[model samples]
Target: MDLVDIDDLSVTDLGAVLDRAAELKAGSGPEAGTSAGQPLDGQTLAMIFEKPSTRTRVSFETGMTQLGGHAIFLGPDDIHLGHGEPIRDTARAVSRYADFIMARVFDHTDVEGLAEYATVPVVNGLTDDAHPCQTLADLLTVREKFGFDSHVAWVGDGNNVCQSFVLGAAMVGLDVTVATPEGYGIDDAVYERAAELGDPPERTTDPEAAVADADVVYTDVWVSMGQEDEREEKLRAFEGFQVTTELLGDRPLMHCLPAHRGEEVTDEALESDNAIVWDQAENRMHAQNGLLVWLAERS
Candidate 1:
């Protein structure tokens, strides 16, 4: 099965992955790629990247290596999809060589196409529509800190990351409140899906109101990778939404990093004692390790 979105796995499966990640973090897992730990011992992963990345690339590669699997990085220049090779053709070819395929691309449909054609399981490392991997790590981090009962307030663009968080949080039984500019609300399809999972996030344009009763406050960059042209506009729209020390009070902060400090979040808030961003970042590897192990077992 491919992990192209948050709902691809049932609630039980998601819980299993999170539980395994917690166990791995506590040092209960077997040795890397040895004995019982090496579930993907002879497997290979082919990663296709149409956009640049740091955490996504490093985390996946390191996670695969630690799992006793090899990962091949194919950057934009290395891939021929832009040079006229069809996505289906690339998917078919890669499936022959790799045990799994992971693609970080601009278009969500591109990843969908890869999954449609590839025989091996396909994972969406990132896309314009969703980021299940990051959501998985965020869930793990939240579970470690506040469990599933805490209320999470999201203050920023209702972008792909936010959409994924909304859906995942709903499935895991967390209350979510999203505060974004009027014109920058969460996607309709994603919100509807989130409602299906559980309670949909309470929406608002007032960031402060959203965080009033929040146990954890989260934010992301005002402008994403492909939205460079909209930077100035986005900045203007998200002006009053920054997660400042005053805004957070004693509530912990969460941010998917490569943060545009002073924009969506303040340095004071990020460096504060209540911030759990680092733990969230580190959990990327652990959560993904659980996902890989689970996928291996199922396959």
Candidate 2:
């Protein structure tokens, strides 16, 4: 099975993964701390990146090593997919050489095509449409800071990260309120998917209202990679949407980084004691480590 989206795993499976992630972080589980009995010993993961990254690449590569496995990084220049080779061909070739494949690509269909053709399990590290891996790590971090019952307020563009978190939070029964500019709201399909799981996220145009009673407040860059041309327009649209210290109001802040500090959030809010952003970043490895182990067992 491939984890290309948040709903690919059931609530029970997600719970188990988060529990295992905690155990991995605490260094108490059988697969913890570069131990000899590592579950992924001798395994290999092929990482294909169509876009630049810091956390996704490093976390997955390091997570493989900690699990006693190896990871091979393939950048856009190193891959044939951009040279007109079919995704199916590349997927088949890579599956034969590696135990698993993780792809961070611009097009969502690239990973979908990989999963469709690869014999091994394919993981979507990130895409334009969804970012399930990041959501998984975010969920783990949120669970640690404030249990599942806590309310989360998202204040920024309803991009890939927001859409994925909306689905994952609903699956875990967390109340989520999203505030985006009028034209920057999440896709209708995302709402439909979340509603299928449980309650759809509350939508609004006021960031303050969204975070009013929130236990945690989250935001991301107003303009993501490939959207540089729209930066000025987006900035104008997001005028009052910045997560300043005043906006946070004692609620813990979370940002899937590479934050445009002055744009989506203020330095005071990001560097304050209430910012769990670093913990959220560190949890990426632990959460993905647990996920790799789970996927290996099933595969």
> Could you tally the backbone clashes for each prediction?
0, 0
Task: List where candidate 1 sits over 4 angstroms from the true fold.
Answer: 28-36
Model 2, stretches more than 4 Å misplaced? 28-37
- TM-scores of the candidates are 0.95, 0.96
**Residue range 109-205, candidate 2, lDDT tens digits:** 9899999999999999999999999999999998887888999999999999999999999999999999999989999999999999988999999
lDDT of each: 0.89, 0.91
- State candidate 1's TM-score: 0.95
Tell me the deviation in Å of residue 190 in model 2.
0.4
Candidate RMSDs in Å, in order, are 2.2, 2.0
